[model samples]
Target: MTVYYCSASYYDNCDYWSTSNCTPPGTYCHRGACGTCDNSYYQCAWANLSGFPPENSIADTCGSSWLCNDKHAYDIPKFSCGTVLWVQDLCNDNGLNVTIADHGPYVCKCETNCNSVNLMRIIDLTEAAYIYLEGSFSRGHIPVMIQT
Candidate 1:
């Protein structure tokens, strides 16, 4: 697996200088409120299988047709359009197979819903993934093991 880090320094200037979310030096800006940036760590790995949910209800960063049912987003480097991933919820030993359809959880200097309160979070899953794993989104963030 390949590991990647979102630079804290990149977020510092963007978060402090702009009243709204501004594009970082090397990344594109998506949907966000003012003074927000995503500063998180990420990685790439292998996948065992592919799975799809009953409903594709979320829009990704690119505004694609189908997302991973639970709105799973990816880091810029990891967003390969149709890449598959197997993610496990360390909190409950549950897992789900999903695809990279969006970009996000931008780790910024300030804390926000982007990272779900867990600064270590690399991938952001929507309600569907959480429900499939029988996890609570209110937990803010849960530890996870992901297989690309």
Candidate 2:
């Protein structure tokens, strides 16, 4: 039940951002512009899927493979993360800012991207896609203290 806040890229700086109908049960997340080989044990495998759909169909309804994309496991969420903070602290902080259009709850497992407005979709998946956990949740970033 642990979680952490992953770092985010600057607003609208994506090399070439695009959108597609995710239907449901999925979303799109920006791993990188140049499509870096999301940390591998053997070696790097960066691709150049600047404006293409990922692999996991659910993540991106377009099914439109990018000229280049990185590996992934689950459907990358079509999320516009606001000034992300420790989910725990998020509950405590009263002065928190939720003005960023890039921040919000998040949509997943999209099938047609119709209902999920403003939510981006990515559909790139691979065997070594699990590495995404690195961007999952950190220790100090959130508010989950380790047990002594």
Candidate 3:
């Protein structure tokens, strides 16, 4: 149970740190040289199922509590946190259309007219086939929205 997000005037459960810090006793408010916000969880790093290196967040330590699992389920240092990428599993290539149609954001690719000259390469974050992302742990703060 480690969620730590502080700043609700002083984290006495200002809400949204994952169901009020697992319902318990808290008393930590410091948020400076590192953090403390009247305590409730905040010790990141661990959610690297062995494939997410590019500097997304990996320097862990902070424990109190935080957990959320829609069903695929996960909580506890249970491999840290943060993960979200479900564009139907990266556009389901099987049909060979990594992604293209540019006019509305679906211009992502790893192959297929993703550039033609074809070697498969064009992944700089572009998913607008209606845009829908929620894999990054998603507790709040989500903005890549493009609804047209």
Tell me each candidate's TM-score.
0.41, 0.17, 0.17
Best by TM-score: 1
Tens-place lDDT digits, model 3, residues 8-71: 0011121233233343534222221112111223211122223333233111221222212211
- Candidate 2 per-residue lDDT, tens place, 54-143, comes to 542333433335211232313232322121222112222222211112111122322221122221222222112212322333221221
Tell me each candidate's RMSD, in Å, in order: 15.5, 17.1, 18.1
Lowest-sum lDDT 10-residue window in model 2: 139-148
lDDT of 3 at 7: 8
TM-score, predicted candidate 2 vs. hidden true structure: 0.17
What lDDT score belongs to each candidate, Candidate 1 first? 0.37, 0.24, 0.21
List ranges where model 2 is wrong by over 4 Å: 1-4, 11-74, 79-95, 100-148
User: Which lDDT tens digits does candidate 1 get at residues 1-148?
Assistant: 6332221111212222333444554454532221122222121211111232212212232233322322333332334535656766555668766554443343322222334333233455534555565434455555555665
The lDDT-based order of candidates, best leading, equals 1, 2, 3
- Cα deviation of 55, candidate 3, in Å: 11
Scored against the true structure, residue 58 in model 1 reaches a CA lDDT of: 20
Question: What is the Cα-based lDDT of residue 50 in candidate 2?
Answer: 23
